[model samples]
Target: MARSTGAVGPSGCAATLTEPGAFGGSLGYAQKLSDDDPALPFTPGVDHGYLGVGLDVLGNCFGDWEHRGNGCETTSPAGTAFRIPAPGANMVTLRGPGDGTTGYCFLTATTSNFSTTGPWPSTLPGQLQGPTTSLPAGVTPAAVPSTYKFGFAASTGLFTDVHLIRNVSVHPAAALPQLNLVKQVSAASDVPLPLTPGQQVPYEYVVTNSGNTTLTDVNVTDDRVTGICCPGTTLTSGQTMTCTGTYTVTEADGLAGSVTNTALAHGTTPGGTMVDSPPSEVTLPVQRGPGLRLEKTVDEDRVYRAGDEVSYTYTVTNTGPTELTGIGVTDDRVDGITCQATTLAPGASTTCTGTYTVTQQDAERGNVINIAFARGQSGATTVESPPDTARVDVVTNRPALRIEKSVDDSRPYRVGERITYTYTVTNTGNTELSDVTVVDDRVTDVTCRATTLAPGASTTCTGTYTVTEADAVAGEITNVAVATADNGTVRSEPDQATVQVESKPCHGKDCHKPCHGKDCEPCADQRCEAY
Candidate 1:
């Protein structure tokens, strides 16, 4: 069977075959080998076993090319040198006619390396075999009678080890290429409640070859997106590939209330025919309903006073899947709000201006707070946004003053003695007090340190008074002080301080004598004080 080049040679060893009424012709053959046998490398005088398919052998199954030498190969093993299979192997193989070139005696599932294992049991009926050139189904159109060459690759061959032979045959099969497609949005986060306009929407397409043939010119297309691309054009049978593209969200998409897209995948067969997958589509609602955003702001932060003018700005935007009509802003405190347009498209924005005059009541309260909101109509539905509030602080004119009068010395005073007085003036109101001064009925020339008192500030003033003889006779004297500012618009309640006059003991004959005045009349134990 194997090293049996004696059986297969350039000699006339040919078989018979009826021309097929079918499409193309196929080749096949079968034989069993001992476990320890290795159909190995090509070398002269060494028998290597092999079979030929698709091509009619010029010489034999071993390497005997018509263009080159031919024989049972009395001189060489017939083919060039190549190691045979391992001891227990069953199949031996080589590329080309064993002369070493393109044709592989046994084509494997994927790679071009000719050496093959038990790919023998063909899935198709006839169990086709071939020299893997381009197609693995090896369908030859050329007519030829059945031929066989029993030979060896090197030292020993299938002759001695060749054990069993069964159903060995040949036939043809048609190429069937199929394609499948699936599409999906790339990022889950890119889509939210209301998809942002001008944002990128990424998509991925999966292309798969579902049939038993290779496919080329693979591509995908989307009705709503552009620039679809993929990494390669060819997809082997049962292989998959991914394609990608991006679509930008537009204002029109929002206005329509939803975005709908469809995609189709296409591929070309090796025969230059086109095949298409079923159309796929995805649709999503842009937003639930019409949306409005209102923002209100004052023109400036300057402190306001009574009758002060403040401008309010109302900015309105239409964020939605529909148009807004009869749009305007309203405020509880601001009046006569005017906008540029009565209708707005989705994603459109406009601003309106109005003025509010600060009244005396608002000034007294120190702030002007108002609530404002925007409203619009979408078809038959009336929509309004959440109210926005704006506040303006105003200055209140409430000026006040306070003063306290006190004697510089702490105790009893003598007649005709100089007494120094101190007056403190404080601004107790929120406003500044100008022309602030203190006045005392008994103390004269109250020189003030400052004529103006800022809010929450204090100023000191000084004055001097002399103890009169009458004051000494009265035993005690009191004086009042009041602060005045801003032409009496601000005044303080009067504050007073009193000092006692000390009584002198009568040292002369008056010690036992009664006195007329209270101060000089009498003291304890008949004593008298002189003024």
Candidate 2:
């Protein structure tokens, strides 16, 4: 016999032997045992590990099926072939020779056939239970005409003194790949002060391969953020990786009080199949003064079909310490919003309603997602709440656009003062959009950073407007902006932004007027209008 040395097992994957006969090498004659019962198992090789062997068709016998804790009768082992009884289903055969002598045992596992051969009712008859011979990774062993390996141990409970591996000859490893990912905000972001607009929100993602196989082409991404960096794209089995990413908080996120986002992870298997992990989500609190909260929800609890009438409810609350007037909801898809009350006191709230008939185009794409915001006046300042988003199921890859408009200040302004207006355009659908443009009714020249956008991408456009004497007397300036993408084929509903203009006295002066009973700075030509 040839002499050599090596360690082998499911983990080591040290050797591959395939020929209808006994295994050779240091495992040749099999070590002798001094103490224990003869009934213990010496197969599977998980304790030390399995020697990787790829097989096409199997025709040899595997032994000691009864010692694998299967309770198989030593007298009639042939009846142990496990079957599922499924349509056209079959299982491997287990046979024993008529001779009373102990038979040699071999362990086998499947690769591509894992899908059909698994969800096994119990461990294979020849694989041992507990830890010693336990399969690596504790995953269901594939039962098909695939890889075959044998194991010898350093004395099982009832077997003779068997020597563990004593040599070194390794083979290329086989794979059983699985991927797991976890996402969280960096501890540094958790501070006494809530994160504000333009502040950096750091995130960390932990990636791991939960299976026995190596994974390649691994990637991690966030739906609402970008610029993620990981050391490498390949992960060996049982290896863990950490990736980092960042996002800049927006004013909308602050006004809404929180920012929520989801991250996804995926990897490719050797067999070319892609394995994806369930989405992981994290919500970060944002800086905001006590303000209005609009909770928007849909009535549908199930998937929607064509012609479905979707009812949306808007619950507007005065979360601020002061009262708000002109409280109402405005949606991107509906018109004529009706509310229970147009004014809310410090802690008061009211309900608003709207209805939409799902079109076939929307139903086919999956579901509908709409955004809405509320507007109210607190003293002389006109305040608009941040967006309240709602989703049903899905959206088609068709071109779609969304726009959010906001102004630099909410405090009452005097004539001749300039207000900086920001119009943000976003591509919400699953397709790339070209020539994305924002048109504000008030600002004729809106300049944006990018005119093109991929799905879920956004761009900020800015313009400046000078408050006029007419705007001061009107008490406020309401500016509306609409965005268009895909050469105007897709258009967004109008988004309105308002700023309070100082109330003018009997004769309109460019001077700031303190409200209702308070004096107007630099008294106007005439007496003040209020108490």
Candidate 3:
């Protein structure tokens, strides 16, 4: 009954106790612990007394399971083996009955097999069974074992020790281990190339999954245009129905620039994000031009004689990518030239016609027989044929003419008598003058002249005269001129005048010759005398 201080009992690990037959049976206990640094649990003193002994429990009824000798025993009313002695003390002593007092003793056991019945689970010394072990991140521990022992002195029989094992303490926290995502590269497909400025070629792109987990809520975006109906818009997978999208290119200093885009795949991981594509390019060509040709011919060297028929022809051709519709040809070079049709196909040519009457009035020699041909759009500036002009000379075989006469009056003095006369001419022709000239020759108391004509641009010469008197005469007086330029006989056509003479008598005065007779003449006096 010396219960004055601290005491000891079995380790608090899972307990395995066996108290066989009531006559001082032995018990064993054991448990498991962690590998790093093993630890032993501390068992508490009895919560209450058992088997008529008001003492906390100690070790098994037997000594260490490795040996069967009398266990270094312990017996105290406190149910503890002994006082904890001091800071460095290890072993404790068990009490044996002093001869027939019917007292029991117990000693702790240590073996890999210590159990209540030699069949229960065991723990070697220095092992752990509770919260002393490390819990994984976000995790907790559970299901640890709890057990205790009982021993007593039988009042009417030999000393005996009995024990029962109970489950013991528990601890918990939280822990788990899975996959996550971090850095990644974007995915794209069918990126476009650049061409000219402000012109779009085509572009395409795709988004991919490159992370450790599934992703969700994916959306794509671009500043150049709308992403949904955009040109080159594409899912990472090539299985989408849309083949292409449209983007209008803009003006910039450089050939190209960058545009930011984003994507959101529907899921819980960073792998669900949309990715951008590489930039593309497009190219264009620039140019402009003209098309049509003209040519002309009008019976060569614009020369023709009277009654000659002139023909003009022009050729129009097309030399462009497009057809020359409504084409026309004009001949300002020549008059009376008419265009029949005015249309042409590429590389095609046609001819036009015109005629001129080279009449008798035409110039006989060199003339600028200018012939110009023009071709172009119907109402547009006409493209003239190169060297559109021609020159010509003409010769003619025709007739010619000359004038031949001069005249005044002089013969006799008379009151009302007439006299007539003539002059002649010649025919000048390589050919002859068919029907010669007929003269209208008469004198009203005056003289006159006449002639015959010639052929081949012919010429002639002649003279004229007149006479007068107071008496009447019947016979005519004639004067004639010869033809000088005509070949054989230079025929003379005569012109004539007639005169009448008479007398008047007076008495008591001498009668004198009168200036009014056939023979009467007035001399160079330029005057007439009276009878």
Q: Is candidate 1 or candidate 3 better by TM-score?
A: 1
**Residue-wise lDDT of candidate 2 within 173-206, one digit each (tens)?**
5543267777776633543234556667788777
Candidate 3 weakest ten by summed lDDT: 29-38
Best by TM-score: 1
Q: Kindly list the per-residue Cα lDDT of model 3 for residues 379-402, writing each as its tens digit.
A: 354443333543332324222222
Residue 388's lDDT in candidate 1 = 83
**Lowest lDDT 10-mer window, candidate 2?**
54-63
CA-lDDT, candidates in order: 0.57, 0.56, 0.31
TM-score of 2: 0.26
lDDT of 1: 0.57
State the displacement of the C-alpha of residue 70, model 1, in Å, after optimal TM-score superposition: 99
- Relative to the true structure, candidate 3 reaches a TM of 0.21
> How many clashes does each candidate structure show, in the order listed?
28, 15, 68
Off by over 4 Å in 1: 1-196, 199-249, 256-293, 298-311, 316-332, 335-355, 360-388, 391-401, 431-435, 445-447, 451-454, 489-493, 502-509, 514-531
Instruction: Return the lDDT, model 2, position 24.
Output: 21
Model 1: number of backbone collisions: 28
Error of 2 at 65 (Å): 42
